[model samples]
Target chain A: SQTIHQWPATLVQPVGSPLSLECTVEGTSNPNLYWYRQAAGRGLQLLFYSVGIGQISSEVPQNLSASRPQDRQFILSSKKLLLSDSGFYLCAWSVRGPTEAFFGQGTRLTVV
Target chain B: GESVGLHLPTLSVQEGDNSIINCAYSNSASDYFIWYKQESGKGPQFIIDIRSNMDKRQGQRVTVLLNKTVKHLSLQIAATQPGDSAVYFCADSYSGSARQLTFGSGTQLTVLP
Candidate 1:
């Protein structure tokens, strides 16, 4: 069985502060990783997705960025956080082929 | 560009009654669809999925119907229970790129006792 882990389950950051969220998947290799943000009462917005190491496709232009450092490790970062950046961030992983994704517990980020 | 949307923002159903949630997508090239359920403060959970080639698929007390011509999809829940109350979202994916999923706004289902 594969498990996804995300850290700092809850985060409180000051405005303009740097932000870093990490996601790791165990028991799977070369999986597709994605970063999504869901605002209060809104739908999930795809922020970034990576097919492999150093390869990322961003869906919307924003202050956040994502990176795939290792095959099973993905990181979402921001140089400066904005008030609008606060939301529930989710990390998901899927096999290389057509398979349903497995999501992590998710991180609740609040930028004050 | 592909866009998925739900028909309603909220739905209330009595307990034990059947519930149906509807969705529509604008992308004709999409060949796969999935339904997800999310509770408060939790990530979306995969409920069921259907391939575009198939019109309907059934799972444990859940059925997903796909209408390619109308670009619509629906999820049917039998004997709706209180635990089934949550926000449901419909996602679509293209044939070639099956990894990325485009999600809809989601419909909140409330099961009344």
Candidate 2:
């Protein structure tokens, strides 16, 4: 079975501080990775997605950026965080085609 | 542009009752649809999915219905339980090489015990 893992399940960062969130998937190779954010009581907003290593597509323009360092390792980062950046960040993986995505336990980021 | 939207913002149902959540999409080229459930502070979990070729698909106690003519989709949960309380989101994907999914606002389902 495949499993996705995200670190710093909860994070509190100061405004203008740098941020980094990591996601790794085990038992799968060359999977499509995605980064999503959800505001309080709102639905998910796609931030970025990657088809392969070093290849990322931004769905929305924002302060956040995503990178695929390895086949199953994805990272979301920001040089300087903003108050609006506070939200629940999720990482997901899917097969090549249009398949159902498997998600990891999200990281709740609070930018104060 | 492609987009997915839900008809309701919230739904309240009693335990053991049947629950239905409705969604609508704007892209006629959409060929795949999915329903996801998210608990508080957790990532969205895949519940059920239906392709455009099929009108209905069942999984365990959940069912997904797709209507391409009306660009509408629905999710039905049988014997709703307290554990089923969560936010439900509908997603749509168009037919193309890049299979990107567009998600809806979502409907928060509250199951009262």
- Compute the lDDT of residue B11 as modeled in candidate 2: 100
By summed lDDT, the worst window of 10 consecutive residues in model 2 chain B runs over B93-102
Task: Please compute DockQ, using alpha carbons, for every candidate against the native two-chain complex.
Answer: 0.70, 0.74
Q: What's the TM-score of every candidate structure?
A: 0.97, 0.97
Candidate 2, residues A1-112, lDDT tens digits: the string is 9999998899999999999999999998899999989888677788899999999999888999898989999999999999999999999999988788888999999999
lDDT of each: 0.91, 0.91
Candidate 1: tens digits of C-alpha lDDT, residues B1-113: 47799999999999999999999999998888899999988888999999878999999999999999999999999999999999999998886665588889999999999
Distance from true location, Cα of B59 in model 2, Å: 1.7
Docking category for candidate 2? medium
Count clashes in each candidate, considering only residues at least 3 apart in sequence or on different chains: 0, 0
Interface RMSD to the true structure, each candidate: 1.5, 1.1
DockQ of 1: 0.70
Question: Which pairs of residues collide in model 1?
Answer: none
Summing lDDT over every window of 10 consecutive residues in candidate 1 chain A, give the lowest-scoring window: A96-105
Real interface contacts reproduced by model 2, as a fraction: 0.66
